[model samples]
Target: MQTLSTDVAIIGAGTAGLAAYRAAREHTDKVLLIEGGPHGTTCARVGCMPSKLLIAAAEHAHHASHNGVFGVDYAAPKIDGKKVMQRVQKERDRFVGFVLKSVDSFPAQHKISGYATFVNQQQLQVEQADGTQLTINAHRIVIATGSSPFVPEFLKSAGDRLLINDDLFELTDLPQSVAVFGPGVIGLELGQALSRLGVKVVMFGASGSLGPLQDEKIRDYAHAQFNQEFYLDSAAKVEHISHQGNSVQVRYQHRDKGLISESFDYLLAATGRRANLTQLRIENADLTLDDLGVPVHDRYTGQCGQSPIFIAGDVSNAIPLLHEAADEGKIAGDNAGRSLKNAADVRAGLRRTPIGVVFTEPQIATVGLSLPQLKQRGEHCYAIGEVSFEDQGRSRVMHKNIGLLRVYGEQGTGLLLGAEMFGPAAEHIAHQLAWVIQMRMTVPQILDLPFYHPVIEEGVRTALRDLNHQLHIGPEMVEKCLDCGPGA
Candidate 1:
């Protein structure tokens, strides 16, 4: 066994791990990055980049096929599944190659290609591929082991027929038909993409809401839009699933649709994700495991137990978006480095404005606190402002007017709290709202900002204006310039 020592040891080389490593490197040169799996981060290799590539191809086909509404005539768009997957893989490889290039820059000894297990609080035992062993002792450690797609045992029985986001993009060709087992972000995005790509997609979910939106209005709108695209049993309770030769069968009970039995060419499980901690041997550390079998850590600082270990990224199981993962990694890495000096002022707080999006057409996006979250926190006196894109000028012109945007604000104060939207340019709108919520800006303040006319953003302005009216703050208070004359 070889022995090594480092100032900081970072487990996992995915998004969160890479961010932690970079942040830790700023304070110490003696940092070791350990990867027990592939070098490419999840976003580059599978999660975001590759999935968006598939969505882009699907969007092209969808737009061409549905151009009649725009008075644009074209031949029926036929997609080649093999070529589509090839393009996605080619671009995905490029992204993965970029991450690998960064990994190659570190000293060969600084990176370990092995499975890491905790021997104790400060010591780790790593087993290499060729059966060699290495022991690493570090003053501080950051665990960013990421996560894995949680497929049900019944679904996994189908073997090669089971497709998770991890393997969805790796396919040589798209399956002729698919039964999507969940209608969360992964399920909805992939299911819609596949449907647009000319695959028969049937989606099943326990709730009518799409993703994690807490607003019933937006959820119902999303359900309607998505239901129009494919066969979705939103109120489904899946009882059994099994493999049938090359295909898979699903048995479910639907609220209004009654018992339904269906089979498809493949089964894609978007049930959810579980933290990758089976081999972490966290019991050797002083950290306390949560109900989900993940180490309990401070959300703001990522400190685990009373030790110098921190947990971040998908492993923390807070917010699973790539951007949030990076934020968590930075916090963990920064705190891990500062722990050497016992610095009390070195820790940073986690992001308060939560921004999440599903990249389906007429994208679904939410920012900051949702209606349910606010209600759960005992906030009940908020005002709601909403706009339907169905009548919005820009959406009407673009023929993309099939969703709604709702903003929540303090009833009397007009302070913007959160927003949920299902509309065109929802990604941009959600991002802007996130910034507004982060800055604690009110609806009137947001309205004071410039909004170009006849654009998707006008929808936001309309919502804010409606909120301003409901708040009934005097014009002088809302318009800060009201007290000023022409040349005050």
Candidate 2:
């Protein structure tokens, strides 16, 4: 057995782990980064970059086939599934290579290839692949183990035909038919993409929820828009799943059509992911655990009950987005590195305004506190401003007029709280709203900002204008206000 001591030891050499390493090294030279699996961010390897590559391909194919509405006629474009997957794989590997290069630049002594388990709050036992065991005693520890897809036991009936988002990216060719379970971000994006690329996709969800939208109005609107492209049952009643040779057979209750049986080339499980915590043997760490088995830590400081332990990234189970993970890692690493010198150093870090985006045609986006979050404070505490893209100038001109935008404001202060949007250029619009919310801007303040004429952003102004009226602080919205011009 080998024993080592370090100022800070970070588990999992992914996004948060890498960030933690850099942050901790700024305060102390004795820092170690440990990894059990390959060193690449979830975003680069499986989550964000690869998925976006696939989506990009799907978008091009869809636009090529649907340009007839623009007074331009084109024959249906042939989708070469092999070429699509090849490009996706090639680009995905390139992104992973960049991450690997970064990791390679780190000091060799600071990197350890092993699986770590907690021996105590400040001690870890690492088992290397070459049958070597090492005990690590650190002044502080950060858990950034990340997460994995959670497949229900029932889905195991499909045997080798079952697939997850991780497996989907490894495919060399798109399947002919796919039955996607879970209408969350992964499912909706992949399902829609495959359908657009000439694959028959049927998405099923247990909860009647779409990607990240808490507002029912926006959720329903986005749901309808997606259904127009592919068959999606957000609230599906699935009976059974079984393996049938090279295919998977599914029995489910179809809405308005009663019971139905179907077979697919693969059963794609887009079910939620669980934090990778169990293998660490956290029971020995004497940490307070939540119902989901995650440590109960301070979100601002990333400290676990005033101990030398810190948690970050997807393992924190707070915000699973990549940006949030990076922020949390920096906060946890900075605090962990400085905690031994001064307790005051373990202060709150910068937690940015929340923002989420789903890259589907007529994208989905949420900024700041959602409508449900505001309602939790009290229904009357906030007012809503809404705009339908059905008649928005730019959206109509581009034939992308198919979504809704709802902006929220505090009743008395008229402060912009959050927004949920499903529309053309929603991803860009969400960023603007997030920045405004972070700056604590008010509805009128946002309205005062310059908006370029005849743009999708004008729709945002429309919502803000409506919100201003609802707050009784501005003139009532005029029907086809001449100042706003036609389709404004």
Candidate 3:
């Protein structure tokens, strides 16, 4: 057995872990970064980058097939499944290589290749691949082990025919058919992409949820828009899942067709993800735990019940986005490193305004506080402003007119609070809204910003104008206003 000591020890060399290491190094050189698996971020390896690459290919195919509305005629797009997967895999490995390069640049002495288990609040036991054990006594510890996909117990019956988002990228060619068991971000994105790429896809959700939209109206609008291209049931009653030869069979109650059985090349379990905390033997960590057995920690300071131990990233379960994980990791690492010099060095870190985007056709985005979050806080003094892309000039010009955008503002102050959108250029609009929300701008202030004529952003101006009216600060919206030009 070998024993070592460090000022700070961070688990999992992922996005959060790498960020933590960099942050901790700023405060102390006596920091150790530990990894049990390969070095690469979830975004680079399986989550964001690869998925977007696949989505890009899907968009190209979809646009080619749907451009007839503009009198632009093209033969049906030929989807080379093998070439699509080849590009996805090739680009995915390139992204992973960049991450590996970054990890390689770090000092060798600071990196440990082993799986770590908690011995106590301040101690860890790591088992290396070479059959050696090392005991590490860290002055402060940061847990950033990230998360793994969660498969429902019943889905396991599909045996080897089952797949997850991670497994999907490994395929040599796109499957002929897929039955997606969740309509969350991963399911919707992958399911729709597959459908666009000439694969048969059916997506099912346990609850009446579509993407990340909180507004029921927007969810319904998005549900309809997606169904126009592929089969989706936001709330499904599935009967059984079984392995049939090389394929997976799904039996479910269809909304209009009654009970139905469908066979697919794979049963994708996109249910959800759970924090990777169980294997650490947290029971022996001597820390307060939540109902789900995760450490009770303050998200602001990343401190676990005033202990020297900190939690960050997906393991923290605050927000699973990559940017949030990076922020939390920096906070945890900074606090952990500074605590070595003085325990009082712990302080709340910068928390950015919440912004999320789902890269689906039309797209789905949420900025700042969602409507459900406001209601959860027992706040009622707010007004909603809405715009439909179905008639927006730019959207209509592009023949991409489908979906809705809703902006929220404080009733009295007229301050922009948040927005939920399922519309064209939602990803771009969400970034603009996020900036204003972070700056604490009002509806009128946002309207004062220049909106180019006949652009998709004119739709945003329309929503804000409506919000201003609802706040009693601007004139009532005029339908097809001649003064605001065609789209406005």
**Candidate 3 lDDT score relative to the true structure:** 0.91
TM-scores of all candidate predictions against the true structure: 0.94, 0.99, 0.98
Q: Model 1: residues >4 Å from true position, as ranges? A: 253-258, 343-345, 349-352, 474-488
Kindly report which residue stretches of model 3 are placed more than 4 angstroms away from their true locations once superposed. Answer: 377-379
Computed on alpha carbons, the lDDT of every model, listed in order, comes to: 0.84, 0.92, 0.91
**Superposed model 2: Cα runs more than 4 Å off:** none
Candidate 3 lDDT by residue in tens digits, 1-488: 89999999999989899899999999999999999988889999999999999999998888775655778777788999999999999999999999999999999999999999999988999998787999999999999999999998999999999999999999999999999988999998899999999999999998898878899889988898888888899889999999999999999998889999999999999998999998899988899998888899998999999888999999987789999999999999989987888898899999998999999988999999889876775666888899999989989988888879999999878899999999889989999999999999999988889988889999998899999998899999988988778865
Relative to the true structure, candidate 3 reaches a TM of 0.98
Question: 133-237 in candidate 2: lDDT tens per residue?
Answer: 999999999999999999999988999999999999999899999999999999989999899999999999988988898999888888888888888999999
Ranking by lDDT: 2, 3, 1
